[model samples]
Target: MIHEISAVAFRQNLGEMLNQVQYRHDSILIKKDGKPVAALIDARLFERIRRMPARFDALCHRIETAYAAVPEAEGLAEIDAAVAETRAGR
Candidate 1:
């Protein structure tokens, strides 16, 4: 579950919020001045989130190397074909 709270409210109920996240795996979205500013998520989830950027970079690098020898137009045409096939529920 997810809960949205103002910054002030979060600060005031920090202990309770932490308990909720710790025991129930709830996520807290913190806002300031009615605008979203930050979030409080489970530690394990946070760890996974922290690793996403490195994983994404590695995936991009692998794709780039795999397609390095392909011509731009040919690559784009293949991508378009694949997208169309997927959209058609192939």
Candidate 2:
């Protein structure tokens, strides 16, 4: 479950919040001035989240290299067709 708490309340109960996240797999969203500012999540989930950018970069690089010889118009057309096909449930 996710808990939305203000910055002040989060600061005042940091330890309790940490325990909730550690033991119950609960996520805490911290807000400042009534707007969400940050979140506290389990360390393992955080690790996976941290790796996403690197993984995305690697995937982008691989696709770019594979498509380097394709013309821009053809590449765009292929992407459009693929998107349309998927959206059309095929």
**Cα-based RMSD of the predictions, in order?**
1.8, 1.8
lDDT, residue 35, model 2 = 97
Candidates' lDDT values, in order? 0.98, 0.98
Best TM-score goes to which candidate?
A: 1
- For model 1, the stretches where C-alpha displacement exceeds 4 angstroms are 87-90
Query: If candidate 2 were superposed on the true structure by all CA atoms, what would the RMSD be?
Result: 1.8
**Each prediction's TM-score against the native?**
0.86, 0.85
Compose the digit string of candidate 1's lDDT tens values, residues 33-59: 989999999999999999999999999
lDDT of 2 at 2: 99
